[model samples]
Target: MRALLVEDNDRLAGLLVTGLRRAGWTADVVDSLDAAIAACRTHQFDAVLLDRGLPDGDGLDMLRALRDAAPPPAILVLTARGGLPERVEGLNRGADDYLVKPVALEELVARLNAAVRRMRGGRRGPILVGRLEYDPISRAVTIGGVPFDPPPRERLLLEHLLQAMPRPLGKEALEERLDSFERGIGSNAVEVYVHRLRRRMEDMRAGVSIETVRGVGYRLRAVD
Candidate 1:
């Protein structure tokens, strides 16, 4: 999952980003409401963690704008304003959930997941391609009902491939999707991960295969 965290507090933002990444999420931080608006315009995010007080104006203003988005992202109001009235106002203004400051990392992640699930209108069944099965909500992948756990990045790569299906995902697109602002990765990073994941799939006798398209990228195809 990808998230946009609009927070001016550098320390808090760093901690939240680190925690979210550890939980298998990609997160980007923007300090002000204007930056958040711009970031949202340029990148697609699964969730947005917003703060009420910002350097420019109230975070609720952004929430108002986000409600107009074609497919608005799940918004969580994470601010120090813990009062009941503030919480009510946030929800009324289109926040999927309102969480106060000093929240637990685990709880925050859980709430974010819950909010997203709610926005998605509950969980959908696992994606099945040949013998490979992937549970989008749980981030679990299996083959023929057996457990399959790869390293985080490899798992994410596999998910992207599975989701895209017949359409090949370009190498540049994969690199951008896998890249996080906090990490400095090599230009050939996508190739490395694809190679590792492809080898693992082969070793497990996975029914699906990663087919490389020369001058293009890669696609997942079910073996006959």
Candidate 2:
């Protein structure tokens, strides 16, 4: 999953970004509310972790603006203010969840997972398509009950495609979800990964295929 971390504290932001990447999430850290807004406007993220206090402006205002924007991503507020009213206000402003400072990395990951799960309408865990099953928490994929070892980026690509199963996802949207602010991705990188994944799935005799839309994008479909 791709996430945006809107925290002004440089040290804390770095730590959180590292921890999130280790847990299979690509996180982009922005120190100011203005930068955060700009990031949200330009890119798409699976979730956003907004610190209530930013250097230039209130994080709550940023969150409200994000909620008002077109195609808003899920927002989770991270703050030191662990009071009743503060939490209430955050939620009222469209924060999906609130996390207090000095939070455990594991808990933050779990909460983020829960937020995404809730947003997906509480779908059953470990997405299944044909003979393949993908577990986001474990970051594992198994085909015909046998595990296939795919690199992290490949796995991330597969996860995104599976999440939007049966729907055609344009190349631009796929790239937006896969690229991080810190990483430089090639224009044809998505095609390369999709080709690799197709071969692997074929080797495993998985009853699915990644279909190209010819000038549009791709789709994951079950093959009879």
Candidate 3:
């Protein structure tokens, strides 16, 4: 999943970004409300980890703006203000979930997943397509109930394709979702991942195929 992390503290933001990447997330870090707003305008993030205190303004100020986004990303308010009224205010202001500071990475990720699941209509169970099964939370891939571990990039590509079944995901969209800003993404990067994943699925007889949509992009469909 892709996330926008709005935090001013350099050290904490770095740690969170590393932890999130380790947890299989592509995260973009911004330190101020202005930068966060700009990022929201630019990227299509699945969620936003918001810190209340910022150099320019209260982070909640941008909450309403973020809420206005089409298919708005799930918003989680992370702050040192743990007061009851503060938490209530944050939620009332359209935050999906609220977490006080000094949170464990595990707990943060769990809560973020829960929020995302709720946003996606509670699709928390394993996704089954033909003989292939994927557990979104665990990011585990299984074929005919046998565990299958692909390379990390391939795994991420499969997850995105599964989530976007039927509807083809454009190359640009796939590239944006799979990579972050710091890295220089190659033009054929998505194609490479797609090819690798397709080969693996075919070799495993997973009964699914990655179909190229010609001018569009790619879609995952069950084989006849």
Per-model TM against the reference:
0.87, 0.88, 0.93
Question: Order of all candidates by lDDT, from best down to worst?
Answer: 3, 1, 2
Worst 10 residues of 1 by lDDT: 176-185
- Between 1 and 3, whose lDDT is larger? 3
Quote the RMSD, in angstroms, for model 2: 2.3
Stretches of model 2 off by over 4 angstroms after superposition? 124-127, 135-140
Model 1 ranges off by over 4 Å? 144-146, 213-216
- On the 0 to 100 scale, the lDDT of residue 24 in model 3 is 78
Q: Write the per-residue lDDT of candidate 2 for residues 13-118, one digit (tens) a residue.
A: 9999999988778789999988988888888777899997777977898776777766667889999998999999999878999888989999999899888777
Best by lDDT: 3
Per-residue lDDT tens digits for candidate 3, residues 51-155, read: 999999888999889988887899999999999999999999999999999999999999988888778887677888888999986778899888888866677
RMSD of each: 2.3, 2.3, 1.7
Residue 152 in candidate 2, Cα distance off native in Å: 2.4
Query: Which model scores highest in TM-score?
Result: 3
